[model samples]
Target chain A: MESSSNRLFSARDLIGFAVLIAIIFVVLPIALDGFRLNLFGKYLTYAFVAVGLVLCWGMGGILSLGQGVFFGLGGYCMAMFLKLEASTPENTSIQSTPGIPDFMDWNQLTALPAWWEPFNSLFITLIAVILVPVVFAFIIGVAMFRRRVGGVYFAIITQAFAAILTILIIGQQGFTGGVNGITDLRTLKGWDIRSEEAKEILYFVNGGLLIVCLVIAQYVRKSKLGRLLIAMRDQEDRVRFSGYDVASFKIFIFCLGAAFAAVGGAMFTLQVGFMSPTLVGIVPSIEMVIFCAVGGRLSILGAVYGALLVNWAKTSLSESFPELWLLGLGGLFIAVVMVFPNGLAGVYAEHVEPRLMALLGKSKAAAPDSAANETPAE
Target chain B: MFSDYTMNELGAIFAMQGFAGLILFSVFVLMALGLAIIFGQMGVINMAHGEFMILGAYVTYLTSNLFADYLPSVFGLYFFVAMILAFIASGALGLFVEWVMIRHLYKRPLDTLLATWGLSLILQQVYRSVFGAREVGVSIPDWMMGSLPMTDMIEVPINGIFVMVLATGISLAVYFMMYRSSWGLQVRAISQNRMMADAVGINTAWTDRLTFGIGCGVAGVAGSAFTMIGSTGPTAGQLYIVDTFLVVVFGGAASLLGTIASAFSISQAQSIMEFFLSGSMAKVLTLLTVVGILMIRPQGLFTLKLRK
Candidate 1:
């Protein structure tokens, strides 16, 4: 019951965090050249989402399949800003409507649309990046959680949300850049973002923000509200009977998860320089869940590893043999759910950690005790 | 929006769109009925539902080819044979999946969703590999190719009528099987109280398998009928999965009447709105409405009374 309020970082947790930091911040920068490091940085952006999933789905047991919606919303918000800046009158001097985006010009729009007006301001766009998804998450969370509609039903509804958003984006091609997405992103507030230096800077910024998100997630996990979330997840009625506002907790964590995902989305657009409906759709949303599942949904650090490893595998496999990626991903989904419900983190905690402890001349009992202590509060 | 069209033109437009909506409704009903049975009865989120439908579409495509090449004289009669074969093929696959995957995750509904999603991905890949990535079209037999001239401006396609008839017949068959048979009682009994049904000598596992199979079989039939109105592709089923699930969910999961009512309303709304707005805006509005209503009424339009 008091597990949430335990030491914020056990020695094991500190070591894991340190190792994760070393990989993301130090080793990768040294080993990989510019392009690959930028790719890893993109993967780290997704890690922010995985960390949020670790809290929302792993601990709170509220599986939102539409995390991509939040991510996309965040990315688009930033992309809108970058796109507007890139589509300045001087930048598009030859177009019929010099101030408007090229896609809008192609679609025969004479002026910048009303919605695109606010995005011209960088401050507003930055605020909108986080606020848009958080608000959307709040509405969804409050509506569903308050009604106590959850489990597979919630999962399906969220998935439907992703589908709806994708369709809307694709259908509104004139405004959204359609299936091609918001491309030709060139600069951010006069800084030429297409430079290799900018890519490296964005990569570091993405990594730095991910680490910040990790700390925030760790704080939430060690807080009393985290305990309440676990308590509600495992036994909702019990928490309700105990006079706690179960819905409020669920809504908070869900919104928090959305905020984290939104940040990741913004970072994704920053590093990748594009935002599209493809990333904001049903397939990518579900794939995001797989990242959390593979990493060890229960472990925040594991989530970072999960995002890195899965994305790494996806890039390498798809690059070589695109046909095998889907098969491998499908097989991995089944294997993770059935064979390793605890995921990579679970495997490590159960098998590898104990062996490591023994080799360190420490008591093996401690490893099993920690594992048992983290049994989702059920 | 109505200012551009006079009364007669508006009437004609509404009538044409309404008929189109009815055809869409038939497709929705066909798709939703199977989902309602599987999701409501078995508590398994079969994300591969669309794939099952696509399997039927592929089966129909194969049967059409076979008739075209091997039995030209009976090409007109190939559709009926195709429908039956599609049902069998999809049902068999559903049964296999139930045994291998679904049964293991019955205790974890969320896990079932993920596992079945994985299953959907694998099935989609298989279809893509076997049938190629291109969408396939069945040759409309000579008899089903023309249109019925209801008026100068309101012509109806024979294929649409055929699909409507097929949908009605299958829906009636499903109604009979669910309400007027002993098997359906066992299914309902299991859905209501699995432990009690098991204690009362019901073959719960077998019933579950059969229910899943039947659901997939129905989806196969839906897919077969679908080829008349649209092209079939490896991922065709995915395009409609969300809409079908919405239909089932909006109708109240366990209620057949609710499913039909919801499907009718959604399809009609979509078709009618599509005529007035852009196709994407219409879809967005219709889905947004359904989702909004669902948020407010999560049990859906109708819910069965049961003790928790």
Candidate 2:
């Protein structure tokens, strides 16, 4: 196992990771064309969301179907900021717009609500991007976890939360952007979103953020809590018996995952400069799962990989077949589960763990009872 | 005439809203029943449950198309055949899945979730390939489509009543099967104690597959019924997954009584709220209320002895 650890840390795996990224970057540009690369930025943002899901779902035994809640939370937070800044009397953006936003006009609002105040500041917007979702998750997680709501019940409840949130946003229309969602921003920090450079920068920024997330998740995976999370996944009862308050741990991870998703959602809105009720709805929330599923939800790398692949396939297929994408994406998922069940990350983990184990010469000590601790997880 | 008109308007709205809730209740019941069988009988968290329901819906869509083109004169009657075929198709797919994959992974309940999720994606894509990506409107017949007039002012949708009756009858039949029949006894025994059931000479494998088949089949029935009122698309089942799961879990994993109670409560609450408030606010309030209540009572309406 010492050799295994050494082997795992070998330069080859590092090279492999880089090579994969390089291939993705090169191939996406070539195959997708410039216009398609514009769409790839959105896929990258979704990949960011997939990472959040991988944590709560792939690692922890929590099946969070409402990740879109955090994603939308982040997007709406950013949109609030843009709307505040863009609402100046001199800015044509605010001209002809009634009371507040057009939706609010319809809702018969006479003035901007006080809650809309902090949104004008980029600083406050950044703080809100993380704070709101964390606060919401904290409250909800505390409530649900204290009572020990879990399994299919927990997943369903969270999903309902996502569905209801979208409806609420749409219904409020004025403050929340309603069905039209927040759109047509002039610029993000003086860079035209419609410009090619801005789009490319958005892509690189998303890609880089994904990498940072991967490293942080990796650290977490190797930490004490990570192993504890695995234990919780395998046997929460046993873990609880071990004297750890299981609920707190779940709450901690859920909050962390929400933050990650919020970051992604915030960046996504910055890139696209739009937010819509559909983005927060139940359907897109489930689509996040497909990204995790095909990418191998258990692996950080798999989460991003799944996101990029599924979204890429969707864009390409939707363009060519216009309608064949769903069939293809669905079939691909079944095939991956059937043939590549480990997911891309699972496949990576298999080779990386063994070789790294051999290189580090740790396998020699990992002899008889090692298998007992190697819990096979979902 | 003035009193009659006023009374008629109120009656019509009430009837529409009331039956809409009933239809919603039926959909929840069918979805939750399939999920409960798998989760309760096999103890596997089959997250792909919604996909199965979607499968049934697509089958209904095809059946609708087939009838429209080939059996025009008897188009309405084709619905019966479609329902049966959807049941068989989804059930058969379930059986194939059990044999090919799920059988090996039941021990890992949560792992099966991810695998089945992948399987769901595969199924959805297959549907998209065969059908198209855009929503498919499963056309109902004239008799099924029209309304039944109760008073000059109040009209009840024929389809809504038809669905409610169909759901009630199917649910009763399933209930009888699970509680009254020999096979049902075998299923309960296995779910209660799989090792012990096998020790007692019950064919555990056969039971697992059959239960899974029936679960998926019921989902198909639910899916087909959903097409009557809901949108039909490659990913249509995604809409009901949460509601269905909520009903099953809130009801209690293996308890049919729990499902019905949960379904009735949630649907009625949602529908009534929609009548009073905007649709979105109603949904938000309903969910928030469910979550709030769940925060206190996690085992849901009925407490099952998952006292492991």
Candidate 3:
């Protein structure tokens, strides 16, 4: 059990599997049109959220219903930066632009307010994606976790935070872009987003980021910190007996998840070139949790798979029969929850084992779950 | 017309805003009470709670439509009947969900949030399919419409008085049901310790269903009543969910009195500020204040701890 050299997957095998994933994602842009690419871009942003849920929820057992708060925080930060960059240097009276965020016109606000001056720099905006959510999360997490808030209690608190944030953003029409939110950005760093090269670059970036996150997560899943996290999730009191600072671990994982969510937000803003309060709210936040649950929260790739699949279904369902979309979504969750308590990945682990990673061959000598009962801290 | 009131008019302004605030507080209390019952006693987060309220609103709408067709002269009385019907309809659904879905997942509260959230979306779409997308305005009966005669400067709306009275009466009835009744005793016992109650031969399953139904039934009544102040639409429930959640949570999970107090404070702050500031600004101020207060008292306004 303690052999250092014997590992689940060798470095070469991981690289090969990564290559196959790269090929599929890298080829997708060429295979699909602009509209489809845009839709996938939205999915990628959602996957950003899934990545975080994998840690905070799957591993830490923190059923945070409002990852959207972090997602929105990041999105708003990027949106603010994008808006600044898009603004003319001369402060020309930006004419009655029809789709130019409704808040700007509703408040009859003239020339960007003084508070918005700093977001003008793209670099700062980028930095804010990480900083704002981290700070907010740390403050919130520390206060709550220190009190040993876990389970549904923790979830409801986070939801309330998201709700308050949403209401504040919606009500503060001028500053936060209100209900309509920020929109109508022309470019990012002078690169035409419409160009094929730019689209491919975005795709590669999203895909690469996803894999890098996967690797980091893998290491964390196996490390002592990971075991400690799982231990914390199962029984906090016991972990305390084992001499671990449960509060710090909770905060660390929570912050790591938030940071990943922000990165997703940044990439999403770059793709959509806009952000709205609706992007991060109670509704979307709950949806992210559902995605993780449905995909099997304990598995990293399962979360990614769930995010992609659920988003695809949402898009297609809403577009196909707008009337039945909600019903279909609800029914799907019911079926998933009722049928697969461990989620879709659990099904694969049970039945379609050899088929999933077929590239590695049917009877691979070693596989993860090297210890069958041992669950990864996803 | 919208500027701050003159010194002479300030008393009248405060009186009006205060009355409006009271009504608003009543609505919050009603909404939060139902949620508190479900969450506190049952340990379940019913995300579709707003949908149950919508069902109540629809019932009221249907009752209005029925009265208009059958006996237009007796239309005002339809509200009472409609509220009962909505209570039954939504409660029946709550019972069904508790028995079928929620019962199995009793130990997993977070999962219930997602499952119910999905349920809410489904119910909303169903309402949209049936009610149509446009906001449906319920006709306030002649007696209920317009304002009550008061001093020249202070004219309180008839509906505001109606809501306040109804909220107080219903909340009292609910309190009686929860605190003073045998059924409520069983519910309290179950909430306190499920295994102990089960050992004591309480009909735990039935209690769970009935408690959930009552919570939803209260939500139904709230929805029916909300048709007076707010618009009736498929998505109307979404409007109150945030505010209701805030009130319930700020009041703490275990205390009903806290719910009432929290509602009173939040609503009063909102309405008073709205008189001077814009609607949005008032909301921002209220939220900032609540967040600050919650940061201090994470257990909420009235933290009633028994088990711990």
Top candidate on lDDT is 1
Docking class of 3: acceptable
- Indicate which candidate wins on DockQ: 1
- What is the number of residue pairs that collide in model 2? 28
In model 1, what are the clashing residue pairs, if there are any? none
Q: What is the Å distance of residue A233 in model 1 from its true position?
A: 1.4
Descending-DockQ candidate ranking: 1, 2, 3
For candidate 1, lDDT tens digit of each residue in A258-329?
Answer: 999999999999899999999999889999999999989888888988999999999999999998888889
lDDT of 3 by residue, A186-237 (tens): 6687776656667667767887787777777766776777777778777778
lDDT of 2 by residue, B154-223 (tens): 6668888778887898889889989999999999888878888999999999888888888888888888
C-alpha positional error of residue B25 in candidate 1 after TM-score superposition, expressed in Å: 0.3
Which number leads on TM-score?
1
Candidate 2 runs further than 4 Å off: A1-43, A93-99, A102-108, A189-194, A200-212, A290-298, A322-324, A335-338, A349-375, B1-16, B44-82, B128-146, B151-153, B224-233
DockQ of each: 0.65, 0.45, 0.43
lDDT winner between candidates 1 and 2? 1
Candidate 2 residue lDDT tens string, A1-378? 334332322253365468657855676766766667777878888987888777787778787878899999999999887766555555535535543655555666768889987787788889999999989888878988877877656676778788888878878887787888988665666657667778777777877787777667766765678778878888888999999999998998899888888888988887787888788876688788778877876767777878888887777778788656655665665565556655776665566657776898875432322232233454
Per-residue C-alpha lDDT of model 1 across residues B99-179, encoded as one tens digit per residue: 998888888888888888888888888988999989999997999999999999899889999999998999899999998
Which of candidates 1 and 3 is the stronger one according to TM-score?
1
